[model samples]
Target: MSKIKTKFTERIGIDMPILGFSHSTDVTAALTKAGGMGVYGIAHDPPDKVQARIDAVRGQIGSRPFGIDIMMPKGMPESETLESVQAKLPQANLEFVEGIAKKYKVPEATTKTFYNTVLRSPSYFEGQLQVLLSSDVDLVAFGVGLTPDAVGRLKAVGKIVGALIGSPHHFDAYRDIGLDFIVAQGSEAGAHTGTIGTMVLVPEIVQMAGDLPVLAAGGIGHGSQIAAALAMGAQGVWLGTSWLATSEHAQGDHAIGDRLRGKLFAAGSGDTRITRGSSGKPQRQIRSAWTEEWASPDAPEPLKMPYQHALVGDLMTAIEEHEVDPLLHSPAGQGVTWSLELRSVAQVFQALSDQTIAGLDLVNSISKSP
Candidate 1:
């Protein structure tokens, strides 16, 4: 029997329907080389750093296809002058953040350093997009704060515009604005995700998306899950947490990687807490001192999207620079446990695709009926 082709497979110029997520340059290039799309998250990086990362991926992958993931939640767009954004931030919030910094034993200079740099801006997506376009990105996917104008501009360039949404209702919003595809990300997805789990989210989004392809995300790592998604009518799968453990994901420091791997094996289900500790929105992160303090009643209510993330920006930098585990924040979904043993992006993508085909075959055989 011939292999089934998915709309996503054709649209993104990949042989497999996997969308590997990692901030790691190596993993992004490896996934593209291995026949699946590699999506790099650029929302958190400064413009210069983001450009360098894109350049690194291009240098590695050459003409192979890849995409960029920019997070746009309900907050500031980076387009505004950094000074303007800094002015808008409440003084009280900064004071509170500093208090926590002091309590965490974070150096005053370190706390000040975050505020001085890593300014918040979703609007900078266009600037980042412009950079990616100059490179070799095949698709540019936007999540959270996607604007109509940005969607139009991306499509005008003949680029595939994928908006990741938590609900089917938002699909209409994007469709109305002309998105090429909608990534129906369930709550199970890692990094800033919504409440609805993938099982119910994918079909709902597919139905609402009209002719646009819907890629199922959140909690999908294995072939059976991909097969289930395809059976339910999704055109492809966007796998993030699955790639965290891949050899390509050198993004995580040694401590972060150890904690992540430890979570997988010790499994009473790794601890999860919905905290406004990172990026402000109530995102799920592995339980840690920062998140725990933020969740505590004494801590001020996490600021809304931009404010929340802005408040903690310095701390994240500190964590990275110091290589501190407690300060290391990871965005993850329920499916992260399936990720173990770092392999190349190609290996992970092939495993997902091959398994999906096998799972689909098994289902079809059963359905062929006696």
Candidate 2:
């Protein structure tokens, strides 16, 4: 058995130092049953759908502790209706998407219902927060920073609030703002990451955070990396890309699971690039023709925030619906090269535990020999 233990596992009541982030209820339940915490990604779902997903995970986990991650940007603009945002998308970008669809032989399909779904907008932020407060979720994690008032409200309702940060400066800024824990996400991470690598970022944030527990995220797909993170003073590892190829991830005709699995299988460490074209935030994504098109010189600049996301909402829907393999892309870290095999969540957790123990043993042996 692995000897890894930290305040994070103790506080969260989990056996392992692995925290899996996924949008699938199956994956979350499997991770919980495997003795690690599973944080469901609900930032992309509306409030009503978010509650339903939470309930689904609860139905399977049965009293096990799990968390939910949401995006609550600090000092967000005033709430704007989804329609209003969609209407503001520039025609040039619209024409570009149309051109891509035509070039790819994408069928004509109305994505009106998809466009109307308001997942992560300023307008739905409060409603999403209320959903978490009223649910049985053991923890609530903010992908972006949250206001002190919002953090206090979550804590008042007996929820442990955590935040993900990319730099020590952001950590220093928000360290004393009532965050229960901080996830130091490095540049190699999937979505919305910073410029520092995990080796440098984790320890820096851990030092800056003082007693607050820091979870090392980004480029952590293997057990050796988990042991290394613990050695770097991280309480645990926050993993998302590693779970993307798991058996329990969304896999169907309409889902991007199969394509993502294929891409990870064929990808190398250098195959991903960080581009702001996806959501107007610099995020690491598997290189594909879709990303290539966005990076081309003739492509219009990606709009900011909700507008960029809104602009491509229907295009993404069409890609998913039509299974455009060339255009299919998902947020994946540099460690994606390690995720070549499709394993069950339980198997993945077991491998992490075994590898962590082996890695620690290797270090111990080397130290004794010296």
Candidate 3:
């Protein structure tokens, strides 16, 4: 009955061409209940926590189809231990984090055990995948990269598998590898992304994918952008930053929620920067003292994947405990300029749908005028 239906939406049983990618189960459930699909990001959590989060979402949304996103590094070292990884971290990087703590006057962090178990071994990664396979989730999405064997395994279990790719080369490589869909993430997207902007990247990926449905991501925060993506041949839009300012975000601490909401509201289109300093990958996050300091000439070069993540794990916790605004940062896309208000998930879905319809109507009217 909706004009926005696409093969992707039909396959997933959602009414609209929107997918909310969030870390919060509440956000995921709310988006699904509102007619768009929600993709729970389970990359950071341990297996037990991941299962619990999935169970909670399943309980809330009933049988509505939902998906899970995970990080799958293409190239991991043959062997790595937490202690060995820590040993390799440069002293300058440690000094830099300490200097930031001292400058912010942040107190010592609470003795909380941070989980890096998944990064410690390949078996841990397999364990996380096993948890998803055993669950009732309708779809599984992988970022960074996924192996053909993994894709085959998920497909064999009747789980729809999708992957995020930035270039046509990557898409071509995986297109025949049994992917049900592809998310074309651009440079303007939050988290780990490549250097291509959406306008150029989407159409290219759509053409390259041929029959495989493509979802456009990056710089898409409003209905007009959705309309643009559809015109560019994207089956749907994959959104991240737009949901951070929504009411359903999992900011348990009221102070932290308020701080994040305020920063998102205050940020303009140009306030974000792409840097490998935070995650050891090119992630677009709101510019802050942490990002700026990392860019300084005296700063140490960031380590690779799991190592960089491990190095900052405890430090980020300490900063969060202290509520250091300058040091606090979240991956936010260039679309953040549109996130100037904290609205409910339902309101956001409605707004995007209405705007998309209006945009389509305008195009129809113009095409018929002369």
lDDT of each: 0.71, 0.82, 0.83
**Is candidate 1 or 2 superior in TM-score?**
2
Off by over 4 Å in 1: 1-4, 74-116, 251-270, 367-370
Better of 1 and 3 by lDDT: 3
lDDT computed for candidate 2: 0.82
Report the lDDT tens digits of candidate 3 across residue range 221-254: 8898898899999999999888888887845311
User: Candidate 1 residues 154-248, lDDT tens each?
Assistant: 77777777888887677656678877777888887777777888999988888877688888898787889999998988988888777766665
TM-score of every model versus the real structure: 0.86, 0.94, 0.94
CA-only RMSD, every prediction: 3.5, 2.1, 2.1
| Model 3, runs deviating above 4 Å | 1-3, 111-120, 250-256, 368-370
**Model 2 shows how many backbone clashes?**
0
Model 2 agreement with the true structure over 1-370: per-residue lDDT tens digits: 4446788899889899999888778888888889899999877777777888888889998999999998876544566766787777789988998898889987755554333355355657888888888899998888975778878999999998899999878887787788889999999888788899999999988888888899999988889998899989999999988888888885521134676678888887899988777777787898988889999999999877766777777777677666687887888889888887888888888988999888878877784543
Weakest lDDT window of 10 consecutive positions for candidate 2: 250-259
